[model samples]
Target: MPRRQHITVFAILALFAFIGTSFVLMFRSQPQGADYPGPTSQEPVLVDNEILLGTATAPKLENETLKAELGNAAWKVLHTTMAKFPDKPTEEDSQALKSYIHLFARLYPCGECARHFQQILAKFPPQVATRSTAAAWACHVHNEVNKSLKKDLFDCSKIGDFYDCGCADDGPVKGKEKEKEKDGFKQLELEKEG
Candidate 1:
């Protein structure tokens, strides 16, 4: 009787252990944390709705050479605008431009160009002063890149009488005989009146 009771107690413990192990395994199999799914399981950071319009991916301003090129381009654009409307940019425009430059630096990291620009900005300092001008410039560069890419991707139609309706109708008589016939009747009326 004693042996049977000992066996029964051991069996019950074993069953409980099995059940506990199964529960743990089941829990482990399920994903934890926020229920929201992200871009990839490997990507630690997920940016939602941060996609730039007209682009599947951001412009890759990776190397120092590229950075210098972008900087030159941006500077040229800003300078031209400033020249065109001397007082129009104001403090805000300067700040915005500086911000754009900094952004380009971060993306491209042209050491020489960045150093030169930094010194110039420090001495002259654009109208609007920000706490971290360099950092702001970095962000601005990104904005500029995005803006440029968007502009290149999407070309708006000019508002004018001239328009391409995407139809291939050369010399006005390939597909509308009825319309042509109506015009002919108007010409006949004018002739009869004359």
Candidate 2:
């Protein structure tokens, strides 16, 4: 076999080894036996009539670098999601967004950070009535986290400018469509008169 072929084979083997190890570590890390279910008997915590996962403790993520990277990525995902939410959401849509925030806090990788977020959720309780309110709520909660971490607070009013999400602007579409429909009707009336 050529040297390049040998190198390719070695790389393939290394990749497979890495993937296998990752699977093993992931499964091994799961909580064993009875503790896996987490909080069976106690009543679930609730805020705004939404059920919350109880404050079960998790081992703190001690690696500061990894924690910071995770925090940045998570915040981007969260802010963008809120930014794209429907302008006038249904009750179910509102509830789903509220539930997702609670779940995200409950399952956040940094255990100590997750607990802090849970406390924030309990106090703030996700304002999901509309896109503007939901996005504002997310900004406010992010500011709360920033405050707790002694970081510079973000100006909530300028949140949309910061998290653009690069999606097309949907804010004015409904009003524009209504105007077009009214003009279309007027054109039809003129045609019938002729």
Candidate 3:
């Protein structure tokens, strides 16, 4: 392994470790709040910097386009992550993906969207047992979300071809496994500790 590559991998791992720990502590310390059940167009948000045991309030969206764009971008990254998940993930790998899915629900900038995802997750936990299952799972949940919003549904059968990472196009890229994609890597909290 090259020295620079090793260092980068080490750094990303460390970052995830730190974020995961913070999330655990935060979860333990969340203050009591009103219970909100079911889907809502607007949801409570964790204030910036206060996410480590923060309050949930409805964040005002300046416009409709912003919300749509954010949700679209987040879904793209999430679907792509599922597409690239290992064919047969180990316990740790599966846990990482699972944790990321939940963490994403918390960190999603749109409070209501986050709440909706959390509700969706409760109904359909992340299926990270294998690549095909995980991808299909993502598509199903996304369709559920679409149904809730009265949006067009996507066909799961074509998801694999729709979100190819292109990593396989030129054969396997060595060291690619350690390299973090932008998707949810930036928000990798709730990690599974070994």
Best by TM-score: 2
Instruction: Indicate the TM-score of model 3.
Output: 0.57
Which residue pairs overlap in candidate 2's backbone? none
Q: Per-residue CA lDDT of candidate 1, range 1-194, in tens? A: 69999999999999999999999999997788847664586766532223211112224445867776766676555433322322234565555554554443333344444444444444444332322232223334334444644633211111011122222333453547645533432332101100
Off by over 4 Å in 1: 1-74, 84-86, 89-95, 101-109, 127-194
The number of the candidate with the highest lDDT is 2
Candidate 2 Cα deviation (angstroms), residue 61 = 0.4
Best-to-worst ranking by lDDT:
2, 3, 1
lDDT of each: 0.42, 0.76, 0.73
Query: Residue pairs in steric clash, candidate 1?
Result: 99-137, 99-140, 100-140, 100-141, 102-137, 102-138, 103-137, 103-138
**Poorest 10 consecutive residues by lDDT, candidate 1:** 154-163
Model 3, which residues run further than 4 Å from truth? 1-62, 167-194
lDDT by residue (tens digit), candidate 2, 11-120: 99999999999999999988677365744578664455344566635569999999999999999999999878876899889888877888888778899999999988
Better of 1 and 3 by lDDT: 3
